[model samples]
Target: MKNIYKGLILSLLVLGVGLAGCSNDDNNPSPDGKDYASLDDKLDYSLARNEVDFLMETYEKDADRKYHDAELPTKFTEEQNVFMQNALTINLNHSAPVVVLPMLRGIDGNGEKVYYIITEASDFKMAKKLGVNYSPKLKYARGSEGVQKATVNGDGYMVFEGSVDFSPVRRIEPGTGEFAFPPSVAQPGAVGDENYSPIVVLPSNLVLNATPVKNVTGLHDRIPEGERSLDLDEMWVTLQILDGFQGGRAYYYHLVTDAYDQVPATIELGIYAPKLGKIPQFGQSTLDEESALLGFSPVGNGIDDLQSDNRQGLSSAILSDQNGSGSLAPLDPINVFPIEPQNELEKNNNYSPLWDAHISKWTDEAIEKGYQRRITSFQDLKSLVDKGWVVSFTPDAGPVNSYVAGLNASNAIINCPVIAHPKN
Candidate 1:
């Protein structure tokens, strides 16, 4: 019996050693294969990124064909002329590049021309002096930072390019938490998943010239915020359309920022896509309007401590002076079913009647008080509603406001929806 136990232990040890050998062999492949130790070796070692590389190559080819006519200037003088022509049309006021020319051959090798485009006949004449024929107008549309999310596309690719303005850095601060629908809002009814979109928080611009963050685990997570000394000015953001528009809207990221500080900021600018209408900038006002329109319902038993009873369900009530005679009436509570054992997996799921109740209350309020529109720009999302339809993007200070008020107020120190409600 002792010998048998010893044999069994020996067999297990041998198996473990064999497995370790296989793992080591997998981790350290031949020189021809991916080298896990070297960043340079892994830079081009991606099967999935091959598609993106192909897309990028295809984009450069298309750009060259569209602008460069698939040819580089033969002479240095011609290259200089092309460079200067591109430099003239640069719109410095915009936070992003509207038009950019690929590298122009220079005595010092390939060099980029900033804000360079031939916008007029005179600019062409100037280029003609150097014996180069340049286009008088831009060949590509000046919008679209589309992102492709679909696995396959039978349709040809559609590209988008947009200039994001982070000049208002205060508005795009992180932790502002004003990008998407407030999660605290009660969602007890039949709300489709398509209706909610990720509100990404990103720096208003990429610090391409900032000092790079070291020891990044993956390329996807790294932010090369150029030099630490330079302020984050602008970022080149690109979005692509996929699956012929059914895939989703062109809102590329939830947020973009270069600020290293831990403060929360939000991206409140508008995104334009054919299917998404104008991506409305969601703000505190919108949250309040949504809450009122949603009739303040309690979130699923407070996010913390799931085992506790859903006492927070009581906060869903909407108190108001219905008759306008100074006497207020509180609406009845929406009963939330206890989190059943079978539904334990979906514990975080919202089960409040808040959304439906708010919709009902909003319709009634709109009918009783009529809706009003307060025209505002993307820069200012403050809403202008007192009790009825809050049309503006300003922050709301209602009694039944959610944490958005506190977060937005805190981030106030610094710092979307379309008509066709998107699916989950």
Candidate 2:
């Protein structure tokens, strides 16, 4: 009887192990599943209505086609399907880290330009926003620079940028205890990432250029009063963004100087909504407003921790998150392009400090966010081609410089990417 009992217990343990394995099998699916399946269906076009309207206006005179679901009426026709397939092939040439040309492009039958477009920015969603230009446009000042955060997308704030140390300061502040700079904010970088070190600096327009002096305050009227060379010197002007009511706006960053004139090879600019003043420059955001289609989170979580090893349940996490709806978790994809040489502006201005390492993407929580990563093992040149909604092109070929130009034109500090994203 004792021997029989022992054998029965061993059998039960084996059954338990088998059940656990089956459960994991049921849970796991490949990453990029939805994105791949959507591509296969060829009907998941999501170009925005306004963009569609623009396209329609551009090609309405032609009698060759109809329109349905914001697509050319004959979008499913054989010729149209061929064109779409070709466009997808071009887009999916998956050689890019951030999915180059994240949209569909084609020519209308009338020989007019027809773009199956996606909106990098749109005003349709309430409280949606983007930067226009640098403001308070100061050249000189004292202490703390630039403004950020605080719902500055609507009509009550002004977008401002200021210069600081040109060298990238990775450890922004020592001993993490809330931030010292108020009215201004910057996104926190990982403890260690081959990060963009930006010294916060004052903008060229803020104050008159002054030599490094001692004990000076930004936006103060007394700097001109002193004649001594050693009194409160000005070095880096704190950059700031003004937010709040038009008449009562306050400067979030106190716009001052870093104790010297010499800055660094790189710099970080601050953007924010200051307390209101005479003129309202930027807008306000609220829970009442809809969510941004884009998202921003540590790429390591999605791109590194998850994609690199397919560790634990990472791929399954991506699939489940992108099942359909959206969440605002930090795991969103921010677009990033590897800084390449031979670019004119990067060479001349050398202003990489102004760029963020990650561009924001369509946001959702960890549970709802699925990774849309594409990896390929290339043994040859042609292997660099892109696949699906992911396309990559090498600048060496023709330097489709237009791609860079489009990025500049959008002035997109970062674009939030969408998973199973709708076009617009």
Candidate 3:
């Protein structure tokens, strides 16, 4: 009996040792020999509202300044990182970087209260300091009824002449064709009045794009629990809670789609333009200096190429059917621009809101050989382009005898901030 007891104790000790070894190995490698780590493991997600409060306080103090051309930090700071993490947690499924800005309340032509978020400030320093992109070209958007004028009040809040109506039911139906190039009908949920444009000129001659986020009040109660998404036609809205000096305050964060980047090419589909003159430069930093971060070669003399209404920038890239039917269809009117930053290093070094645009078409031999398929990655697209299975072109020079895609001009400017790139 004594011998049996001793033997059992030894067996248990050996089992425990084996289990410990296995647990440690599990952390280092998987069956496929890939080391996996959760986002939580790599990042600290502790909430820090004081950081945001400090930044906002600084911005308010400098609000009355006439010019803000001072150099600002380009890289993310500790405060910015904290705010980004908290904002990203509101919706983990977001495809683009989530930017959270302070909402300015105003009464529209109607007596109801509306909220707007500022993106591009005409002052390059102010724009960078606020963590938003700069657009000196917004100065030209003034004088149009499409552009709304606003004044910063004593409380540092914006007072606008009119507001956007976000209660419209947004819908889009793709055409019955295999590619569904042009949607049978498409409508954005939010619409501004005749006086409303995304561009807002301030009292200090500072022009900025103030995009509408929410119009109706009490819509928060309608959102389901554990679900933060409130789809508004093409745009999405999510509520965020911040613990500031004023205590807990709720703000709305808007998620807008970005122009899909196809390596050396950029493709744009939509925009909110009340008139041709109201179209602001999509990703430019200043009027004279092109963005060092975003590589782009404009189609014509800058924004002038898009002035004509007849230009319909459509690409011949066929959308492949998901069910393996191998049917081809025309793409929607997409404004393609030639871009640089061909590799990950260039992308990381000078990452800008501006994306390079390219038009890709499958070659006749590729389609005949069944080598044409949907591209899954930047590498795959480049590989096909190299093998002559696919041919790429500038917006000005498309495939021979093809239908005229739209003009090589940007039609849309999505307010999406890039957070991180995937390591594949």
Candidate 4:
């Protein structure tokens, strides 16, 4: 009897040990299941806003390091950082622009959870806050079938679990005080999209300038939630890419963008919008209703409220190759369409759209300075040198003379001031 009882106890202990080992195997993850080496503790996503806060902090760090790098454009400093951080830390996502870069897996908006982090920080960490606002938020994919699991982050600091898509985020420009934008937004849409363009430029001389861009008041009295548009008189820039371009080196044209209705339209004038960065679009022109130009179309919807005061803006660039060949050619009516190769200026044919009044005034000034004869268009401005006038072309550091030249009482115009040949 004693032997039988001892044997039974031993057998039961063995069975218990086997069962515990099997359970452990099923519950524990395999080595290949995770890449925890580069992972930080999975974001402390225990609270409602915690996820957003964490992301915001992460982006703040990235942008701070990126822009403040001593060797680079060291444009934003510590003080500016504070201003940017505060401005960007927002309860209202629509009124501000935000961009997000995630290291998460299986959660992306259009593609690999990444974006071009364009921002302006005077210190409030605008870029980071923006990233948090725009990046993945755990939302349900518009249409989901049953039994579907929505996990925002397959890994740390990752995705917006519920939905694969969300609203489009606007690209932030420090100079432009604009906020939210739709994703399908056309290329030139934000940068002076003839339709939804903002007022970015103002004239150097006010006499001939157009009114700055403005918004229609009483359009429902107040702006709705999730609508991020700029307020009038705020300095902003138009972001654009021309028809032919490689990569997204977007051009930033600065403007006050408020005039039109206010301009006591004495005569139609050009508005001056300066470039804050490199203007990637090589050649430029103001299109007439009948002409086709490669650049932005002047056609837009909110002309009633937002108006660009056409005046000359200030810009400068070194013209690479200047083969002084005195030549006069007829304006190709075909240029009525956008810039095609055939319409490219012949070797010495330089032309810009300028008001007759402006040309007459400048020509008179040169004559007053004891010049032999007057030059005609902007190309003529360059030709003054060969014709015996001091046709001086100097590399400039600040604004384009167009500020003075383009300014009308209501407008300013900044056409291509630089005839730079592409640097190889």
Candidate 5:
């Protein structure tokens, strides 16, 4: 009887050892179905505002490097990464009034887990507590369906989740009244289409120097969230390509927004005169020296040619081909009997719908400097050269002047003052 009891005890011991071995398997599951060790220890998600001190310290040490590297999250959605970057950036700014909120766990569009934060941009006292030098004000906007929104003082508001959209950014140049547009997004509407091209109404007194191209259009400005339409005076001088130059169809675009605060209407005409044209001196071009005929040199790469590193001799071979005859011909008007071909300047032929002023009022200084001639037609432009008066042109830099020289021959207008039509 004692031996039978011993055998039974041995069998029980063996069975207990087998159960322990099964419990210690690498694939053993926790209550959440994931391996106990596989779960992230740092993510103690049950606690609201989880581990703020530790998270902030971790972010403060490594956030910049991660942001710069565009390091995305592996366990979370991309939007979470954007939120982190935005929070870190604003919190770090010495002048911005902001504080980062703790991570709140959530799910994204694909049902994947993500983390996000709610920032306090409106609290100046919080900014002071963070050691900010100056408390900058903030504007708020309702965020998009899946993204967060933030505002910059001069750059307008930005929307981001994993990426940023800058379509709402707008800028106004202080003295020149130059406008940087905030482009609009296309929306699906149920009723009549509300979309329209950018339009500007000019003061009724200004006459167009040239026959303005009929098809030249304005930009499409979109209103961003948390902001109203711009009310400041803004203008843009741009060039438009109609068809191909090879097909002999191209024109310049002169855009002007209405004057506010009694700012007098003026035009800054940018031009594109190919150096290959023969009537102008061969292999000579300058925006500096005044032309004998026009008050300003009639040449430019147009707005399309602005470059940072500076383009060189781009059109020399083409312009230099026929000595001078190969240069571009002026846009000549058709079906006007009394109008001569030489007088068919595009500038004089086109005027904007907003142009209402028939007489352009010139400043006293301009009249004294012999630049007060009223340019009624192409004939008037020729008269400037016929009278032997110096015509001014402005080249932004030396490389542009040098490039112009290769086509026209001389770099006469390299350093001329930028031509401006001062207000009356």
Candidate 6:
């Protein structure tokens, strides 16, 4: 009887080892047959440098493609240019390139300058000509204390009645927290008045998601306009200039750091919201159909956690300590890339400013099986999902678990634009 029991135990151990080996083999292969444990391993960091050089060269060679004007140059086929123009108008109601200019709002108590980006314009003609989003819905956001009225000054800059106070130290410490619950500490950096929201009404009565960027009181001087690289600071923040080609025409985007509910992740780069439905847009179809057509899908629980009342799902950065310490320390820039579509062919020239919001949380099973670990890359997140150690879904369907929701019907979305594919 003792021998029989020992034999059964040994067989079980061998089976477990075999399964483990198969899981590792299945999850780690790159396109070139190279084994990489993390998605960052497959990324060619030099591509970003090359992209910056290309942008500089394009800027110097073609005055029409200059960065400030927000116009699509004539280099592209008329049809392609028209398509992009229509997309901006129909979807975002803006005609500008995916890249936008950030406006400095005010200085925080920390002496950091609060910045915001404009996405939509009120007048259709102005929106088309200026390449900004046009939304009648913006009128609804007006007249509220939280919703500031914006106007275009004689200098061609936007002026706002109220500004956001980004002085708060935004921090999220996971501290061995479960995925579904809130972290040990979570604080938004920026706070507006009682009714302040990122989405504001423009002088033209058109609405726009005036999402806050970062506080750049003195950080821009560290890397002059001519010299910026993918170098990480003590806070693990860096600047990444991403270039993407749509219909064979090259486009550039400036990525500084990602902001969560509030507060800029880093001080150097401009800011963009990594999650969607934080602000209201004109149509639901744009967030649904248009996003998919542009090659974006919801990541984990895609839009399921849109209800702030039920589940609070944080991105990998907000929930992990693998990167570093502090709220900004654990944040990694590489999470911006899509997990699927490792190559250009897979991407099919469908890159857009919309990013797949890969929201994630550690599973109860993961903690019990001792499988809980920091997710550092898209590949790492994908592998865990496959192993049932993590739960990932998209917002294609309605909220399944929660009764009350925050975002109006729209799923949790991410507005990040693709700069360049890692494999490209």
**Best-fitting candidate, measured by TM-score?**
3
Question: Deviation in angstroms for 155 in model 6?
Answer: 5.0
Per-residue lDDT tens digits for candidate 2, residues 1-424, read: 9657534533432222221222211132211122212111111011112223332332222323322122223222332111111111112111221111111222221222212222111111100111111111111111222211111111111112221111222122111222111112122211101111112111111111111111111121112222331111221121111110111111111111121101000011121112101111111111121211111111212233434433221122232222211121111122233221111121121111122111111123322546334221111111212212222211122212122221111111221111111111
Give the alpha carbon lDDT tens digit for every residue of 294-409 in model 3: 22221111111223322222322112211212121112232222221111221112223333333445566876786643343344445665687766433343212111122122
Q: Pick the candidate with the highest lDDT.
A: 3
- Each prediction's RMSD over C-alphas, in Å, is 25.6, 28.9, 22.0, 25.1, 29.1, 24.0
Off by over 4 Å in 4: 1-46, 56-83, 86-107, 116-154, 158-424
TM-score of each: 0.19, 0.20, 0.47, 0.19, 0.17, 0.42
Instruction: Compose the digit string of candidate 1's lDDT tens values, residues 39-112.
Output: 11111112112222232233344344322222343322321212222221222211121212222110100111
Q: What lDDT does the true structure give each of the candidates?
A: 0.19, 0.19, 0.35, 0.20, 0.19, 0.33
Which ten contiguous residues of candidate 6 have the minimum total lDDT?
401-410
Query: Once model 3 is optimally superposed onto the true structure by TM-score, how far is the C-alpha of residue 76 displaced, in angstroms?
Result: 6.4
Per-residue C-alpha lDDT of model 6 across residues 35-91, encoded as one tens digit per residue:
333321222222212222232233323323333233554232423223222121111
* Cα error of candidate 6 at position 394, Å: 12
Q: Could you tell which candidate, 5 or 6, scores higher by lDDT? A: 6
Q: What is the lDDT of candidate 4?
A: 0.20
What tens digits encode model 4's per-residue C-alpha lDDT throughout 148-193? 2122221223221122111112111111112111111111101211
Distance from true location, Cα of 309 in model 4, Å: 9.7
Tell me how far the alpha carbon of residue 143 in candidate 1 is from the true structure, in angstroms, after superposition.
26
Worst 10 residues of 5 by lDDT: 200-209
Better of 1 and 3 by lDDT: 3
TM-score, structure 3 vs. true: 0.47
